[model samples]
Target: MTATSDGTPKVAIILGTRPEIIKCAPLIKACDRRGVDCLLIHTGQHYSEDLDQVFFDQLELPTPDYNLEVGSRSHGEQTGRMLEGIENLLEAHTPDIVLVQGDTNSVLAGALAGAKSNIDVGHVEAGLRSFDREMPEETNRVVTDHVSDYLFAPTEETKRYLERESVPGEIVVTGNTIVDSLYEYRDLAAEKSDVLNELNVAEDDFYLLTAHRAENVDTRDSFDRLLEGVSRFAAQTDREVVYPIHPRAQSRLDEFGLAVPEEIRTIEPLDFLDFLRLESAAALVFTDSGGVQEETCILGTPCVTLRYSTERPETAYVGANCLAGLDPDDIVEAGTMMLGKCADWDVPFGDGRAAERILDVLAVGAEPDAAEVPT
Candidate 1:
């Protein structure tokens, strides 16, 4: 790892999942352009090379300088291990600042470790709230934002959320780096990927489905309901339902004795580029993932969120998304409604310059120390 120097400070970029890899690509490039020495660190929360390698290759992201290999575990265990690993790394590298994106446990771990080390921490996609504390992501975001020295919110709503909390960090509404990445790579995705052809799915010929939340997968009833919903939708619409299954979801499906239907194709998880192509061509998208919710809105694809709520409610408010709680009937109804509707809604996320704005915020000096206050 590179050390901080007088000319240019060393910046540590931390990521653990495919979403993080995609969202951080633009910011990594932005830092490179500014002559910042970037150290990419992978926490290995999601450890499949098949699932993660494509993103690095597709995004042209640098191989991580270090990989903690902190594989699957309970939420507490994973977070605890990541915290220890990241703190040790921060101590060795002595980066001027740490950059973490989104609301993963990895984000929280990186932020806390950096803050404890007295290194400034910058959080991209900060200040998002679903107002549901049961979700681990909500807790992760709350803790990460509190410790963050720089908070890069994607929307004005997010900035307001931070302001309401009286967060001391500099808050800049940088649009969304995901949008920047999507628009930057969409053309390339279209040209390079054979996902459409392989799936026998022509433009607007199929509905996309992705459900991988632990709440939904950890329960047999919930898993069965999700499968039933997809089966019903496929039978009724005669349109293909393509699900690029997360490994955990696939395991749950088997455990529940649920079979993915013939019309409902269950494929391995796709890389970032392939997934983007599928998202752009789909008639409608059904998912529980925050990243998919944001991307579907940007692609102008109507979405039916399989969860009761989403942190990215801006998509729902803009008519690009509808929350259909994990019920077979609701899923079918929402998918039907979306299939018949015209996709003309505007994207609520900003135009693709989020990375530039985020880096600009990070370039500013750190927040004031509480001890510096005068009596």
Candidate 2:
């Protein structure tokens, strides 16, 4: 780590996607509050309005110290480019510890770069598995976990997975940072967002749909099937389906010649606050994103996951989520079932203080002194 003449430890938080920015916000703030020299790196993995720039503005996060601008490419091409860019950056500005989050290709690249450099690496939100190797995210999560030196798992279940896989690290059971963000932003969403008024949709009268997972969107058949399900559900329920189209999803829609129905009004991707308000306002949510599943559970909103499997089985076990793969009939049935079921379960995630716990471990290692955490 390049030390300031005063000698405080230097840390690097590497992130490349919009979700990473959102999840990493509290940790960044903690660093600033505690006087840590934390460097932010944006690999530009998901660079667009909703996916990128708006998050920084709405979340009030500082602009990244470096933007690799390594926009979309094939998986091999994107990861290889990121690995090269991050390695070069690390050589120029060495850090004591490298922290990465979730299972994006960016996370994989960041972890690989740090390990290869012999830097101590911390993997946040570690040990999640869908058991589906076909899902690139599963591969990313598995590979990153193995190489990390500090594994900050979100739950006991995840910790067990790491144990089974024989991952070496101080696997601290810090709750998920997404819980921290949900608590941090939900109030802000209520206070500042006018999404409901702007969309002309009443609370609990719409279905919030977000399908941007590569597994769901990259293929012609799967993409067509998902859209058909959304259309079918809308036709059956006569409920307006609000889809804030992910840039990636929009491209696939055009490429595959699939059409969104009149009932499913597609809008530009929303800023974080706006999206949170919409999530609470919706009667039910249909999504393929892991982050959304956790968000839905925290918001006490019923959700129909548009994937056959989820890394977040806790949500399903708690009666807040239903798994419905890309099949149109299954999607419609699951959405219908979710609409009828009320989210009566308690929050199974965390106590909304995970960011503080995670930052404690990052700042002070496995046994964070109580004094290091604020009251």
Candidate 3:
């Protein structure tokens, strides 16, 4: 109903979390450059100014066209709220396509809302699987991929998974958009982020950590073990571990009366640029975030993934990362092993043009001559 005057398709880009913001930024920028008509919608899954608003400011992304303010709640309640709000939006300003990136409650709700409303939905970073149904993210990823009209798979490995599942979407291997954002912002991060001096840490002399997954941090035993492992690793390596704690993780630590070891320094959440600068320079990065795994691998930094299984197996296969499930001994061993290895692994993501490719596909679908996308 809200088509552009020239029949240029209007796309509604929906996101709710910090990771989604980071991944979708390149596509948003591409839309602006190509004169593609698009509107951004914030689901407000992450409402903290530190976690949400700072990303837009640091990335120079435009303010969202709509903000549902559907703050945190039980998964069912949160998804239900988002579904209701998104359905209303779709009915009111029916866009030609609804675009969502990454696996989250927001992704699932957006895909379902679009599908139910009879509107096309495009899923970015589709077909990634840890194959662990217990992980909520895995469910979100699987459900979103199936409901999407366009599946922008990041690799042949991911494409194979979709093929095996026989998803109905038109599958395109457009590589990962993270590559585009990283390539675009690395130099800017170097020039602008003074995080190193502020933290008083030297490049390649410290370890970086991020463990905020519910499976890891929601339980006391698991959270305590994770901290113990990282503490042990830091002591053995004689290097400080910088942990920019997530709000949820911080809350759990307080509730459980837990503490990080002396060698591990906990700090406030960082904007994308500062975090990118630290990730790029850190000697080793430890995390349970799939995004961090991809980032550290792309930056040629050795990574220790803090989970039993990873959706990003390419990182492990390419010698860029090792999985050390929450055991202290395992974490120390993995850290020691990775510390001895070289950081010259081949990048498996893409050529830094995924956003352009995605927009091109959408443009052709909208109208043959919608806009001329750059090669």
lDDT of each structure? 0.85, 0.86, 0.90
Model 1, range 181-240, lDDT digits (tens) per residue? Answer: 999999998999999988777998898999899998889988888878877987898888
For all candidates, the clash counts are 0, 0, 0
**Segments of candidate 2 deviating more than 4 angstroms:** 1-6, 49-51, 365-375
- Model 2 lDDT per residue over 74-155, tens place: 9999999999999998888888888999999899999999999989899989999999999999999999999999998887
Q: Model 3, residue 62: what's the lDDT?
A: 96
In model 2, pairs of residues that clash are none
The count of backbone overlaps in candidate 2 is 0
Task: State residue 59's C-alpha deviation in candidate 3, in Å.
Answer: 1.3
Poorest stretch of ten by lDDT in candidate 1: 366-375
Prediction 2 global C-alpha lDDT: 0.86
If candidate 3 were superposed on the true structure by all CA atoms, what would the RMSD be? 2.8
Candidate topping lDDT: 3
- Candidate 3 wrong stretches, greater than 4 Å: 1-5, 364-375
Q: Which candidate do you rate higher for lDDT, 1 or 2?
A: 2
> By how many angstroms RMSD does model 1 differ from the true structure?
5.3
